[model samples]
Target chain A: DTAVSQTPKYLVTQMGNDKSIKCEQNLGHDTMYWYKQDSKKFLKIMFSYNNKELIINETVPNRFSPKSPDKAHLNLHINSLELGDSAVYFCASSRFRTSGNEQFFGPGTRLTVL
Target chain B: AQSVAQPEDQVNVAEGNPLTVKCTYSVSGNPYLFWYVQYPNRGLQFLLKYITGDNLVKGSYGFEAEFNKSQTSFHLKKPSALVSDSALYFCAVRAQNTGTASKLTFGTGTRLQVTL
Candidate 1:
């Protein structure tokens, strides 16, 4: 079974277009996270939710918002997408909201804004 | 703030030879280090981690890493390099005492190229 999964593996849209990427995890984990990887392969954490509660919110812009309906799902919505939003976004899950836990990542959603 | 550094942008190795990818980290307190691998167009795969206990940690795909507190490094190593092992590797660190909100910081990544 696919432990962590994300919808729309590839997305191509124009500037000012709004988009949303959905993520789900079946590992029975209590924590979920969102990460962004740039063209240079630099990965950074964008947001994290533990048991449906917002736990970590990095220095991401207000245009980026993350919503967690439950413990198993965390979705990202980008408003007024700009050219700088062209990159791969990854969804991850861990056992808990602890630093020692290793996160399981999904296949990732490649978002390209023209 | 926790940060990780991977000095080499790419490491080339021949098949059947051993390979090593260096990594260093800095944090205010103890660190939870991890190694992840990314194949072409794929997400990051957890290879190994060092939270506590033994300094040497063994992970998937015949990969291992040694954590050195004195040097603040966790270098990934493999006994034999395979052609399929060519991929981008990332080193990440999380500060243990930074509460539950602490996030994992990743390095720029090192591309391992294994040639025949």
Candidate 2:
């Protein structure tokens, strides 16, 4: 079974367009996170949610918002996407109190802005 | 604030040869360090982690890491590397005292090239 999964594996949109990426995890984890990997392969945490509560919010722009409808799901919505938004977005989950506190990541969604 | 640093941008090794990927971290208190590997067109996969216990932690695919508190380093090592082991490796860390909400800070990542 795929522990963590993301939808819309590939998305190509024009500038000023809005898009959303959905993520779900069956690991029964309490925490979910969104990360962005730039062209240079630099990975950075964008947002984190625990039990549907916003926990970690990095210095990301307001144009990007993350919503967690339930503990099992966290979705990212990008408003007025720009060329800079072209990168790979990854979703991850973990049980915070777990011994190792290791996280599992999804396949990732590649976003292209033209 | 916690942070991780992987000094090497790339490390090349031949099959049957041992390999090491260096990682260092800094945190206010103790640190929970992790190592993740990523293949082309794929997401990051958890490899190993150092929470507390033994300084040497063993992980998947014949991989292990040694945690040195004094040096603030957690380096991934493999006795014999395989060509399939070629991929991008990332090191991450999170502060210990920060609640369950603490976010992990990742390194710039090191690309490992294991050739025959």
Candidate 3:
């Protein structure tokens, strides 16, 4: 069974288009996170939610919004997508807010904006 | 502030030879280090971690990592390299003191190529 899963493995759209990527984790983790991997493969943290509460919000633009309806699900919604927004977005989850726990990652969603 | 650094962008090794991927980190307090591997079009797989224990930590797939606190480094090693081991490796660090350190700071990543 896939512990963490993300929907729409690949997404290609034009500039100004809006899209959403859904993530679900069966690990019953309380803390979930979102990371963006650029063309250079530098993974940076974008957002994190603990028990459906927003915890970490990096320097990401306001155009990107993360919604966590529950502790098991966290979805990212991007508005007015631009060329710079093209990258792989990954979802991860951990049992709790501890540094010792390894986060389980989803397969990642590759977004291409033209 | 917490950060991780992977100096080498890529490392090549022949199959059957031992392999090493270097990683260093900086944090305000104790660090919880981790190694993850990602194959083409796949997600990151947890290899091993050093929270608190022996300096040498063993993980899945016969991989191990050594935590050198004095040097602030945690390097991943494998006894024997396989072509199938070719993948992108990432080093991450989380500050134990920072309550908000639940988020991991990842390095730029290192591509390991194991040639047969």
Candidate 4:
């Protein structure tokens, strides 16, 4: 079974378009996270949720929002996507506190704005 | 204020030789360190973690890391590396932040290219 998975492996759209990426995990983990990796291969944390609670929110733009209906899934929504939003978005999950803070990630959604 | 640093942007090693990827960290209090590997087009895979046990922590795929308190470093090492082990490695640190769960700060990343 796949531990973590993301939908629409690649996305290409216009500069003013809207996009959403879905993420799910089957490791019975409670915490889910979103990360943005730039062209330089720098992976930075965007948002993190532990058991449906919004825990960490980095300096991501307000246009980008993460929604978690339950503990098993986390989805990222980007509104009015711009060229700067073109990058790979990763989804991750971890079992908080007692689980040593190790996160498992998804395949990733590569968003391209033209 | 926690941060992890993988000094080398890339590390090259001969396939049958021992390999080491350096990582250093800075945190205010006790830190929980982790090492993850990412193959091309894949998500980050958890390798090992240092949650307070022995200084030398062993993990998946014949990988291990040493936690040096004095140096504030957690470097990943392999006795004999394989060409297939060529991938991107990340070092991360987490502590008691104001978040609901402990948040991790990841290093930039280290690309390992094991050659034959």
TM-score of chain B of each: 0.97, 0.97, 0.97, 0.96
The DockQ-based CAPRI class assigned to model 1 is: medium
**For candidate 3, lDDT tens digit of each residue in B1-116?**
78899999999999999999999999987889999999998999999999997999999999999999999999999999999999999999988867663878999999999998
Window of ten residues with lowest summed lDDT in model 1 chain B: B95-104
Candidate 2 is scored at a TM of 0.98
lDDT of 4 by residue, A15-103 (tens): 98898999999999989999999988888989999889898999988999899999999999999999999999999888886646678
Give each model a TM-score.
Answer: 0.97, 0.98, 0.98, 0.96
Candidate 2, pairs of clashing residues: none
Root-mean-square deviation (CA) per prediction: 1.0, 1.0, 0.9, 1.3
Can you give the DockQ of every candidate in the order shown? 0.74, 0.78, 0.79, 0.73
Candidate 2 residue lDDT tens string, A1-114: 999999999999999999999999999999999999999999999999999999889899999999999999999999999999999999999997765588899999999999
lDDT of 4 by residue, B1-116 (tens): 78888999999999999999999999987788999999998888899999887999999999999999999999999999999999999999887443457678889999999999
Which digits, one per residue and each the tens of the lDDT, describe model 1 over residues A1-114?
A: 999999999999999999999999999999999999999989999999999999999999999999999999999999999999999999999977555899999999999999
Please give the distance, in angstroms, between residue B4's alpha carbon in candidate 4 and its true position after superposition.
1.1
* lDDT value, candidate 1, whole model: 0.95
Q: Which docking band does candidate 4 fall into? A: medium
Alpha-carbon DockQ of candidate 4 = 0.73
TM-score of 1: 0.97
List per-prediction Cα lDDT, in the order shown.
Answer: 0.95, 0.94, 0.94, 0.91
